[model samples]
Target: MGNENSLREQKILSYTGFAAKANKIVYGKRGLRNYIRSFQRKKVILIPKDTGSRVKLDVIKHCQIFDVPYIELNYTKSDLAKTLGKQNISVVGITDENIIEGILKTIQ
Candidate 1:
């Protein structure tokens, strides 16, 4: 069970990496909010487990208001940052439908 969970996490990280490479990833709450407001594309948001309650609630609220689907990942902000080759990020928004589907599927 532990191995399965780890594998799933790796797959999610892999998809996130692809999203970053394709420039479809938006980092941080501000960036994610901007992306949600500006784009018409189908999007998904990933909030790390370790995110602060205030930030997490704010992000989730924005997502709900905008009708964007969000997932709270088991991984931490640092885990996602490492995958994306970025500094620590509280939230990540993916605007590409294919990548979003891939991540959602993996999580499910």
Candidate 2:
């Protein structure tokens, strides 16, 4: 793993059937209403990649331990500020794995 944080983010993305980017993920979580509406997958989550946030870190670890897919990027990491500098990210795409393509299509 290159960066532990990046690896953690990548792990979450893979389960959702997404490939690697920067050896990590570059997607949005709950910060964007449209992105939040994208998934209908079971056991999925949209967590942010912020280590300083207790809630995000704990949730990320739990998802990784369980092999759950998650969206891990946020507005803070977004160059366009697309997600409103997203904060308060939690459960997202918490559904099934099959719907991910449609989810990414809608969100991306």
Among all candidates shown, the one with the greatest TM-score: 1
**How many Å off is the CA of 81 in candidate 2?**
15
TM-score of 2: 0.36
lDDT of 2 by residue, 1-108 (tens): 347555544444444333221221233443323333444334345644442476666556656665655565642333212232333433344334444544444344
The worst-scoring run of ten residues by lDDT in candidate 1 lies at: 35-44
Q: State the lDDT of candidate 1 residue by residue for 49-84, as single tens digits.
A: 999999999888988898888888889999999888
Candidate 2 residue 38 Cα shift, in angstroms, is 20
Taking all chains together, the TM-score of candidate 1 against the true structure is 0.86
Best by lDDT: 1
